[model samples]
Target: MPSMTEPKLISGNANPTLARSIARRMTMHRGINTNLVDARVERFNDQEIFVEVYENVRGEDMFVIQPTSNPANDNLMELLIMADALRRSSAARVTAVIPYFGYARQDRRTKARTPITAKLVANMMVEAGIERVLTLDLHAAQIQGFFDIPVDNLYASPVFALDIRHAFAGRLDEVMVVSPDVGGVARARDLAQRIGVPLSIVDKRREKPGEIAEMTVIGDVTDKVCIIVDDICDTAGTLCKAAETLMNAGAKEVHSYITHGVLSGPAVGRITNSVMKSLVISDSIEPTAAVRDAPNIRIVPTAPMFAQAILNIWNGTSVSSLFDAETLGPIYEGMYSSQ
Candidate 1:
């Protein structure tokens, strides 16, 4: 752990709003004494990313906040080049704080000839002079092993649980937490336990990429408020299909709560036409304008938990409590005073 004064937060063009939100949660103000050096991220005729940090950062413990969201290559290269520049400037330490890690879905190889892009990204960060990393709700937790340095994987379950608690309040019992697939059962289970509700699973089969076949739902959801929980909502196909299945099976109402909202393709339109009553997602990734203006979609901030985690890391405090099942709410006081 590093000292409070040693850490300095920086930002890139990717999701500046989330970075600002995290900063506000950290300092309890709109802006901190941090610097976002003006860098014109451009490419040559050969299509190569170029970055030049305008401000000096000699011997400072720097953290570059950038989510590898849309325009993945551009944002990713920006983070990499920023780290390299900071390294060249003699920074004491560099930590890449990526709220939304892109290409995390390719953590493993399912075919004979395939690239483990997630591990490749980890290698890229390490080679770019990033000594440590901070990320949230990785598609696969084992991806942490891909990195040689310290990789802190934060959980968004606590944040989502609090939101669900407040949003439904007395109607929580009627809610049934639904995991869209078997891979997400653990995540949904955690949320169900926190909100004290029964759990259900959508046993679906992926016939091909970007498509899903909703076979049958396990457990009871009839006449119950259904809540689908997952780490990411990319394309929103599985979620929409699952909601339709739940609705067709006599579910009273259907909703969704996902950590990352990667609303690509026709996801927005699909979600609009789906049987889901509402879709709740966190601001880990920047949503498109259509996603932002969607009537049924809402974004909850993950800034408070992240800001507290940063403070704890700075103060050399225990972050284990953040994952404790019993304490599923953001830690107040201590480092979370502003929250």
Candidate 2:
């Protein structure tokens, strides 16, 4: 960096493995002796969170990595407190790297007397000293408008497209991408177009919470290799059901590529026993023991992508370039260069 102050990375307790992987990729990309900022985010006896940075960050550009996943409230608190700490320590800048942005689903009000928690979170981050936000695959794109600060939302389509190409190389002609519901048609269409495959949608309807969801296929999946695309896979109920619907409609096989694997409750069990061939999720959220042990579950590393984004942001380069397919190829390929 041209500046005398070094760029610093600080991570919270959420998804430490992903934070480390991103740090490693940053090392490879920058070719400098770089590491995460020495910090501790622990809980007190009453479960109160505490964050302390063990270094001088005066005038340094600070990047805080914390994904508000399973324990959304705790992780969110840690992020806010860390940002406050960095600002108080005289850090020149503080950018929030939230791989899996929690409360994204609550972007809109579904019923009366409901709050848009996504907007509230954005307000809280800004008030807590966050200058910028770097997130991946938000549930709703419009969440960006909620933030008054600059928000760079990254997509995982290119990474997933590369894996889909490599995994279904031999049967490219038979592959077709399926969106689990009408709400995901755009995401599914993007992936389908990237790989030059057909597109389908599952019309999902639910009467209310805790009720069984009904799914109906929109396009022909007969004798086709179905690949379901979605942003978050929470319980895997809808995903499993979508796969079953495709199979019942005469699909040759079924697979899924989800960005955030918020695999809570009986998610692992459902995917394991479902008709889907495999479930591919990004490392935005840390995997649980059951998730790792599941035979049908696979994780795709997003460190290289996040790492490149971080570098571009630090260097004042074009982060949007990474979204371009032609530009993304080299970075994704570069990931294997180190391995």
Candidate 3:
């Protein structure tokens, strides 16, 4: 039986900084010396991933922090292997903490003969003996149905709402939340509601993969500063084109707050040269050198929210309360009040 104590945190090579940050927050929140379980993840000569848990995890609750980001295959394999190792080590329960769920964009098939890799990933995790899953802002909410075990899909809206409030405290009236595409209107509308702003949508057509055909602003954005919101920003093509269209529609400025900054391809270059006033993304995926060097890019740390979620899950408390913007508003306001 597992002891009624703090959960053991093990980190993969995917994003150690985020893991460490979560550990630190856990320690502070519990007022105890919470430390990461020592583990070595190395590669063989042939580049096969190897994970060895150094400490005894028998009868302990283990939470492995690994984001399936860049080199998605490698990180995902590491997570699967680590879960297997922990299960074999007699861990009572294993929770896979995947901050950025890779391959989630393929939750459904747009055409025939397409594979739902998201469901495949979920099956792999279950087969690897993951008792639960903790992730942030899944590309599709329905992806939760892919897993049989408990899955907590944490949202970044609370975090983004706080940042948006701080950045435009006195002039929120001039702000408008925009969904870069019609599909993201719900996500953008949530943020807009939280921040008490009107919502707008960008009607876009994609001619091919990773390319935008046309973008048109759906709602009135005249003279208002637009803040485009979405779950992920991959190539930056859509975001850039939307910003341009919004500008042409008489918007004063365009900014963006995305949950996952999967800034792949020419994303950094596009954002740097685009007309966006600022682009803020959560550090769900570890920022690359190019991302960090981008002048218009800012990364919001997600450790605090993830840390709280982990703590809640371990304690068998309700994690849904964490998503309550009303409750989180005052807390975040106090947190950034001095900054």
Best by lDDT: 3
Q: Which ten residues in a row have the lowest lDDT in candidate 1?
A: 330-339
lDDT of model 2, residue 199: 97
User: What are the per-residue Cα lDDT tens digits for candidate 2 across 205-269?
Assistant: 89987555687889899999999999999999888988999999999999999999999999999
Estimated TM-score for each candidate: 0.91, 0.97, 0.97
Candidate with the larger lDDT of 1 and 3: 3
Order of models, best lDDT first? 3, 2, 1
Q: Write the per-residue lDDT of candidate 3 for residues 114-195, one digit (tens) a residue.
A: 9999999999999999999999999999999999999999999988888888888888999999999888988998999988
The segments of candidate 3 whose C-alpha lies over 4 angstroms from its true place after superposition are 1-3, 329-335
What lDDT score goes with residue 15 in model 1?
86
Candidate 3 lowest-lDDT run of ten:
330-339
Preferred candidate (lDDT higher): 2 or 3: 3
Clashing pairs in 3: none
**lDDT, candidate 1, 1-339, per-residue tens:** 556345577788788888777777776622455434455566789988777766667777777889999889889998999899889989888989999999999999999899999999999999999998889999999999999998888888877777777778788879999998888999999889977899999999878987675458998888999999999988888888899899988899999998999999989999989888899998988878999999999998777777777766666676656675345343432322222
* Model 1, CA-based lDDT: 0.83
